[model samples]
Structure formats: structure tokens, C-alpha cells
Target chain A: MTTQASSTAIDAEAAGTVPRLSLNRWTFRTTPVQEFLEATTSRGIEAVGLWRQDVEEVGLDALRRRVDDAGLRVSSLCRGGFLTASAEADRAAALDDNRRAIDETAALGAPTLVMVVGGVDRADKDIVGARARVTEAITELAPYAEQRGVSLSLEPMHPMFAADRAVLSTIDQALDIAEASGSSAVGVVVDTYHVWWDPSLERAVQRAAASDRLLAYQVCDWNLPLAAEPLHSRGYMGDGFIDFPAITRMIAATGFTGDIEVEIFNENVWATPAEESARIIAERYQELVLPYA
Target chain B: MTTQASSTAIDAEAAGTVPRLSLNRWTFRTTPVQEFLEATTSRGIEAVGLWRQDVEEVGLDALRRRVDDAGLRVSSLCRGGFLTASAEADRAAALDDNRRAIDETAALGAPTLVMVVGGVDRADKDIVGARARVTEAITELAPYAEQRGVSLSLEPMHPMFAADRAVLSTIDQALDIAEASGSSAVGVVVDTYHVWWDPSLERAVQRAAASDRLLAYQVCDWNLPLAAEPLHSRGYMGDGFIDFPAITRMIAATGFTGDIEVEIFNENVWATPAEESARIIAERYQELVLPYA
Candidate 1:
């Protein structure tokens, strides 16, 4: 599958077409929905990824129409799954919530719904058990997501978050769950910040693309002198140790033509003006991400 | 091989012999060697693990004799390997230092020299290359360690430390290097704080034990709201979210009767008196670790 995509992508690139960037809402999470859209429009960015909370604050339909009117393509929705609860009632509630998230993704016309699989069960630190629960939950939801026309993109968060945030700690691990679902609606995400440290990522990205499961391409640098929270230590494209071009080349090698989403979660970044942040992010994407993408 | 160990350990346990705890120096890093010794001696703690810096500060020979006189056995030396240098001169220097470290371990009568194989190459973010360097360096040093009768135990640090600390981040990764050396002198350290999150740890521990490569067993909990240094956030046994009995059972299943080293690096733990800290750590280990061991 990737062979054709690779050749076609090369042919297209040689013909002068290039991939575009999708600015994730978490990059400027504090900005109001209207102002965030204005910032994207001002930067001439056609693609934007929205978080669940952001759409909720603005009323989903209102924000959806605003994005549609502004000609902004909804590349992906920020989140969905927290299906690791042990109790049947809690687990059922998680599935219900994810169903709504899927509905919202379709409502916003987003192509994908990114899922951060819940961490360990609260009463015990059984990571293996938690992962099993995640797989079970994704399997149950994949068909629903397929019916709703929004692919479920499972994200492998950094291993540091394995204990408290997401038990899915590697792209291969996420792919295992997605492939087990045996549905095209289930896919995997390649977030550079989460996966750059993986020794097997180069080959894993190739496998993901070959399987046609590479649903989203997310980029963010990982910084040193990590924040106390660890979550807020994600840096701007060029501000950290990640070799962007090398990793981007890995994705490109798989013939990925998806949005190269910039998804940073930094406290200092949140303090910047939305418009200025968008402009700077676009510039960084051009210089650091576009050439390879 | 694990089957043999399991049966033998079962027989031994049936005979009433059990594992013991070794208080790591970092568990009382701020205490004077004499005070640390006094605290351990008073508590009837028979084993301790010393850091390179601490040994260097007090003079290696003096400390060795002190441990002897105090009737305390050295379980394993704190660390040795930082052999991830790309340049020949730097790499050669690293080898020299590791040789000295082996000599120090032999001098101290410690059976194992714990190795934190250094991070990615300084000039590039090539973890793959750095990992290769670590293997090559370990291969070169294995014979020398055998001659010195000090087994080189490769420690797989948490993935979060991959960029700036150790390249070995999984027990299987360490075992690959250890087994490749084809020398009994090469082994692996199973530090719960580092390897607890690994999905394959249960199986990997079995492999390590079967190969007779389980040279040291270290314990420490991972706390949330990481310390400024990140490294200093290690909690006492029960303070963090790790399921101790489940993991400790993996080690015991391997029939590992070696010292169960308490290796916490928390700031608060360091602030207490060495005697008080020793008492608390021992208590936690008994409550959280002993039943499984």
C-alpha cells in the first residue's frame, strides 16, 4: 500500500506540490475560539485541529459553522478515550463519552479523532491490565467511529505519562491495538514528541504507513530541564533536541501526505499572543518542517 | 534456565533462607560515611551500595576497610559506564575510567559494577548510534571486568533519561548487550523505578535470570510532581503508584536471592537523619517488598 503512496507522493512533489501544516488548538490553548480562528486565517493556514474543551466552550455547532465559514479544514479533533476505568458503570460512561466525541468529530467534519488511551486503573498500577482495557475499549468503539465517518487515531504518549495519563507508550503498541480491531476506522498517530526516542520508530512509521494506518502526523520538540509537570515541557519546533528533518523524512518515506500538525503544550508558549504565536509557528513550520514534509 | 532457578529457589525457600535488603548510599547520600555506617550497623543492616563519588571522597581503600570493619557487605557499586563518547580520545578515556571503576568494585569486594550506559552522542541525537557505542564499549570492557572479578551490570534507565542519561532503557536491550559479550562478567540490573513501566518486563526479567545475568536488584518508587532535577523525585517504596508485589514477584520468580537494594533519591528522604531514613526505608521495604520476595 505504501509503495504506491510513496511513488505517487514523489511524483506529486516533483510536480511542485507540497504538504501543508495543521495548527493544533493546544498550541494556543488559552485563545478564544473566534480569535484562534482569526489567528489561523490571518496566517493563511487552511488546516486546524480542535480540542474537545475548546469546541465545548464555544458550543460545537457555532464553532463548526465558524470554522466552515472561515474555510478552515478540521484536520483532527483533540481527544476521545479514557476507557480504562475498572468498574462497569465507569467504563460504560467512558464509551458513551467517546461516542459523543465521535459524533462531535463528525459534526465538525474532522477527518480523525485522536485518542489518549487512559492510564492504569486507579486502584492498582497494573499497566498491562490497563493496556488490555484500552484495547478492549478501542475495539468496541472502532465500528461506531467507522459509522460516524471519523477515524479513531490512537496516540502513543511518552513513556513518562504511562503511569498517570496514557498506558499507550509506543507507536508499535498503539498499532498493535489498532490492528487488532481489524477495521480501517482504527489508526495510529505519529507524534514526534512522543515517539522520537523510540529506537524502532523509523521502521514502525514505515509499517504504519504501509498498513494505511498513519492517520495523523504530529510534531513538537521535547525540551531539557523539564517542567515539574513534565506535560508542559514540550518545546517549539526548533527549541529542543529533536532532529526534525530526520523524523519528518521518516514520515515522508512512508509517503504520508497528511497535515504536519504542530502540537506544543508549553506554559510559556500559552503566554504568547495567539496571532503572534500562529505567525511564528507557521514560520517554524516553513523552515523546520515543510522542506522535509 | 529460569525453570531451574525457579525450582532451586523454591527448594531453598522451603529450607527457610530468604532475600535481604541492601541500603543504597543515595538513600543516605548526605550522611557522612561513618555516620552512614553507624546507622546501618546500629540497625543490623548488613549490606550497602556505594556511589563512585562517595567512594572517591572518602578514599576507596579506607572506605573498603571501613565497610569490612563495620561488618557490612557491598552489594554493588553505584555506577561506572559513561562510554557513549563518539570521539576516539573521549571514548578511550571512558574505557580507562570504567577499568578503574572495575578495579574499585573489586577492591571494595562488590560483586557487580552497575553501568548506566551514557545517552545519545553529544553532536547528534542518534540514540541508535549511541546504543551501538555502548555495546562496543561493553564488549571491550567485559574481559577486563572478568579478570578483575567484577561483573559489569548494565542498568536500563527509564526512557525519559534516554536523551541525557542512559541509552539502555529496557531489560531486553541490556540483555542483548550482556549476552552478546559472551562473558559471565556482563549482566543487567533490574531497578524497579526504571523498568516498572515496561510492558515486557515480566518476561525480560525471566530472560535475565535464566541467563545468570541478573547481577543486581534495585528498588525505588516513582512519585508524581517530579522534582526540579527529575532524578530526585524517587519515592519510598509505598509512596508512589507502582505495584511492588507484582514486580517483586517477577524477581523472586527468577529465584534471585541477592540484596533487594533500597535506592530512593528523593529530596525529603535525604533531609532526614540517616538513622531515621534507614528505619523508614527498611520498614517500607518490609511492608511493600518482603512478602513478595
Candidate 2:
């Protein structure tokens, strides 16, 4: 299956046609949405993964019209969930926000709403409990997401972010949450930058596929020094240590044909012009992912 | 088994005896070994994990005598292996140095020589190749180490260190090398700080125990950001996000009765007096690890 897809992708590239690629908004956070859309459309890249704040900034109605006019594909919305908080009010607010985010994602025609199941919120230090809370929040939100035709993709951020970002640090853990949610609407996002270091990653990806839980496959490289602050230091594809081809092959083996999204959170890259970064990302995607699509 | 051990530990501690703890040399790199040892002894800690460079500074012979005079136990030796260099000359030099380290570890009666199998030589992007080189290096050195009654403990660093520090980044990966080397002398060192983030860690620890592959069990916490440079910034147990007691319980469940060595590499902790650091580490271990033995 992967070979056939790769051949088709190669044929398309040879014919001077661009293959599918999703630009994660975090990569162009420095640029205004209007400028970003203009740049993306100019480059002939049609798909984008929008962040909630980005949508709010552009006004959802205006953003929707711009996306439609540009013929852009909404791959997946950038976020929802920090749902595992200590305060009941905060947790409830998060769920309400997520429900609205799901509605926004549906309005944008995004197939998936990415969720970062959050970290420990109390002094109790119960990671398992935090994970349980995440599972509960997802269960509560899944029916609404399904009704809105939006899949919820639980992105297990890197273990480095386990404290403040996402306690679900592995695909297996995310899949477990999906299973407990009792909704196929809830699935797992396989991000190379976050999970490439996992010894059981291949098996976990296969498990996600077998369980019909694979929602999104994001790509980026694991840079050295690992960065003192993980929020910003992601390496561009092929520029760091991760073997992108090997990892992408594993994701493909899972029968995951989801958009190969480029989600880099590098301060250096974000500071550059959105068009330049987008072009570089698209070009690298062509070089690294197209051949093995 | 863990419950029984914890009870025994509690009884021992209540009797006003000092806990058996080992100081990892990296924690005191800023201090002279003689001064560090003097401080540790003054504080009532009796065991030390020595670094090869520190041994060189004091002269191995003089160092051995100082340890003996101080009645200090050499728990383990800090390292031996950058065995993945691109050049054969460098690889051979690494092995030769490892051989010297084995001899020194034997002289000091340190039971295990920890190995940080070095990362990919920039010219070689093949992680599999680097791993193979590390395996061959271990195989070559295992017999010599066994003959000297010095076991080789392959310490799989955190995956964040996979690019530049050690290609062996999981306990399972380390166990594979030990199994292939076919030398009981070649085993794994399970460090909670590095492996706690691993979702498969519990299963890995159990497998390590079943295979009698555990050589040393080190304790520390996984701090956020993972430090762009992992040589420093390890969190003290109980101060960070890791479920230390749970991990210790998992290790103890394996029926492995190895010493639980405190191997923190935090800059803030190190800048303080070594005696104070050791006391704090001891206290944390008692609060965290001792609960699970």
C-alpha cells in the first residue's frame, strides 16, 4: 500500500504537481493570518492546520471566507485541551472552550480537532489521575465532536512536556484514552518529533492502526541539546537526528494516510518570513516525504 | 517484596542509622575529589560512584588508598565508551581507555563500570550502525571486564541524548546489547531519571529482572525542558514530576536487590555544598524510594 502511494506521489511530483502537505500554524505564528493565507495561496500550498487563537485573530467568519476563496484545505485545527486542571471551574471552562473549538473546526471544514491532554494541575502529583481526568474530558466532548463531523486527535506531546503540557506522552497512552472514551471519534496523533525517541514507537503505531485510532501524522526532527525550553526548539526535517523516512514508513505501515503535517515550533524558524519558512517546509516535505508518501 | 523491603527500611531508619547512598561523581564535578570525599564522609555517606577523570586527577593508586582509608565503598565507575566514533583509531582508543577503566574499577573494587555508548559520529547518520558499533565494543570488552570481576553496565541515557550522548536510549535497547554480548558481565543500569518518561518502563524493568540483566538502579527525577544539555539539570527525586515511588516499586517487584544509587546532575544542587546535597538526596530517597525499597 505504501509503495503504491509512494509511486503515485513520485509520478505527481514528476508531472510538476505539488503533493498534499499541511502547514501547522505554530510554524508561522509571527505572521498575521491574512498575510500567511496570501503567502500560502501564492505558493500553491492549499492545506493549513489552524490554531484557535489564529482563528479568533482573523475572526472566524473572515477566516472562513478567506480559506474558501483561496481553496484551502483545513487539515486539522491546532488545539483544544488543557482540560486536566485542578479547579472544577477551569476544567469546565476548558471543556466549553473545546466544544466551541470543535464547532469552529467543523465550520473551517477541518476533519480533526487536535487536543493536547494537559498536565498535573495539583500538588497531588498523581499523573495517572491527571490522565484519568483527560480521558473523562474527552469522553464528555467526543459525542459533540462526532456530531459536528470533527475527529478529536489526542496529541501526546514529548515527555519533556509531561509536567505542564501533556501528560499523555506516548501513542500507547493516548490510544488508551481513546479506548476508554468509547468513541472512534477520539483518535491519536502520531508526531515524529515527539515520539521518534520511543523504542516501542513502531509497535505503538501499529497498535493505533489496528485499533482504528490513527488520526494525524505530524513530522519534525529531534534536535540535540533537547532545548532547555521545549516549547520552541524543534528542528526542521532532515536537519536533525531523526530518520524521517524510517519514521514516515512506520506511520505508513499503520495504514495512516492522513495529511503529512509539518509542525515545527522553532523560535528561529518562526521569526523568519512566513512565506520563506512555508516554502522551505514544503520543499523539505517534498524531498523527505514525497518520495515515501 | 517491595512492601516488605520498605517496612524493613523504615525500621532501620527509625533506629537512627544512615541510609546506604552513593554519590554520582557528576554531581560534584565542580569540587576536587579529595574535598568532595572529605565532605561526603563528614556527612555520613559512605559510597561513591567515581568518574574516570576524577580518578586520573587523584592518581588511581592514591585514589584507591584514599577511598580505603576513608572506608568508602566504590559503588560504580562513571563511564567507558564513545565507541561509536567514525574512525577506527578513535574506536580503538575508546576501547583501550575502557580497558584501563576496567582495570581501575577492579582495583577500586567497584562492581560495575557504567557505559554511555556514544552517539552517532556526525559523518554517520545511521543510528543502527552506531548501535552495532556499540554492541561490538561491548562484546570485545566484556571478557576483559569479566576476568577482572568488573561488570559492564550499559546505561541507556534518555532518548533526548540519543543524538549526541548515547545511541542506547532505552532499557530494552540496553538489555538487547547485554543479551547479544552473552556476558553476564555486560548488563544494564536502570536510571529512573532517564527511563521514567518511558511508557514501557515498567515492562522493561520486569524483563530486565527476568533476564537477570539489571546491574545498577539509579534514582533521580525527570525535569521539564530536559535541558538542551543533559550533562546537567537532573531534578532531585520528589522535587520533579516523576512517579519515583511507583518506579521504585516496579524495580523492586522484579526482585532485583541492587543498591538504589542517587545519580543527580543538577547544576543548582551541585553548586551547593556536597555534604548538603548528599543529605538532601538521602532524605528524598528515604521519602520516595525507601517507601518502595
Best by lDDT: 1
Residues A216-266 of candidate 1: C-alpha lDDT, one tens digit per residue? 999888888788779888888878767787888889888888787889899
* lDDT by residue for model 1 (B1-293), tens: 13323443455346543237788988898898889988887776778999998778989989998999998889999789888889999999999999999999999999999999988774776677888999899999999999998899899998888878998888988999998888888989999889888877899999999999988989998888678998887999878778888898899888998888899898898889998998887677666777678
Cα deviation of A93, candidate 1, in Å: 1.3
The sequence of per-residue lDDT tens digits that candidate 2 reaches over residues B1-293 is 24445666766577654456677777777888888788767766678889889787888889999999988888899888789886889888998999999998999889999998998666646677788899998999999999999899999887667778898888888998999998888889998777776666888888888888888989888665565566665888877787877787788788877666788787788789877787788777777787676
Per-candidate interface C-alpha RMSD?
A: 1.5, 2.6
Query: Which 10 consecutive positions of candidate 2 chain B have the poorest summed lDDT?
Result: B1-10
Q: Which candidate should be chosen as best, given DockQ against the real structure?
A: 1
What DockQ does model 1 achieve? 0.59
Task: Tell me which residue pairs clash in candidate 2.
Answer: A225-B228
Give the Å shift of residue B204 in candidate 1.
1.6
User: What is residue B169's positional error in candidate 1, in angstroms?
Assistant: 1.5
Q: Per-prediction DockQ scores?
A: 0.59, 0.46
